[model samples]
Target: MKNIRIVITLMLTLSITISNAGTPKNDKIETPNDSLRLAELNDFWAEVSRTVSEGDFEGYKATYHEDAVVVFTTGENKGSVSIAKALRNWEQDFIDTKSGKTRNSVEFRFSQRVGDETTAHETGIFAFQSNNGTGNDNPKQFVHFNALLIKRAEAWLLVMEYQKSKATEEEWNVLE
Candidate 1:
């Protein structure tokens, strides 16, 4: 089962990378709706990313549906942990940095979301750096993100999100 999961993850990473990376002539935004949605999703995601970068856990949590499912493939908190897990993780990470011993940073690249009026799926590349106040600028870890969001009561909320590691930097460079 683990092997299968890894295989599926690899396929998704490859496909998303291919679609977002390089020239991408075949997947251009082809409609007015696409342009509008692209704008909206980008704006909404900007809020989420900002909240994350600032370690605003409550604000970040608000971006997701109450019953959202979030998964981290390369973190210690692995597998189907519900929203509460995120609360815990954020709280702990925040508290861990209380003594001025750490820093958490998030930066996104080449991100885009596409879907219909009530639903959207965003695929992109990002990195979350855990800095221990060292002079080094390298990220301790990073991931490629795939997210699903639903429009509820005219607002968008993430319903499902997945993260994996590697090869997304090139894909991200394709955007900016």
Candidate 2:
């Protein structure tokens, strides 16, 4: 009976080890030239904000990736909008504002790469401009944006963007 118990334990241990060994690791760390990418993406982000602030939809659309998706945090259309339409709609909204003021601009600070050269995930904070406008009705604009960027030939294009404008203490959970 002792021998049978020992054999069962060994079988269970072996099965567990084999199953773990067969599972693939999700970590695909890559040493990307982050400075170059940052420069490029920063330029694009600036262009987007500038175009929107200046009420130039065409200029805003020119900075977007061909298939990029922008998620608007506040305003009428608060969901995902196409690259072209997003520019038009956002420009119109800004123009219709009380003073046509853009108190703060958003920036993208590349965090890290967890995939191949063709694809990578990045994270950054959406900073708020504290100085500008007429009053204190600025919505406390601060958020975090995560993006999945894809390299197409010689250009890097944004494929997906997820944003969380606010998080409560109860939801501070990140499962690895």
Q: Highest TM-score: which candidate?
A: 1
Per-residue lDDT tens digits for candidate 1, residues 1-176, read: 99999999999999998887777566665588777776777778788767755666677778889999888886565686787777786786655444545667766565666698778988877766776668565543447778889989878898998876564455666764
What are the lDDT scores of the predictions, listed in order?
0.73, 0.57
User: Per-residue error at 147 for model 2, in Å?
Assistant: 1.7
TM-scores for all candidates: the values are 0.70, 0.51
Residue 61: error of model 1 in Å?
0.9
Error of 2 at 12 (Å): 23
- What C-alpha lDDT does candidate 2 achieve relative to the native structure? 0.57
Question: Model 2: residues >4 Å from true position, as ranges?
Answer: 1-39, 42-57, 72-78, 93-104, 110-118, 130-140, 167-176
Residue pair clashes in candidate 2: none
The best candidate by lDDT is 1
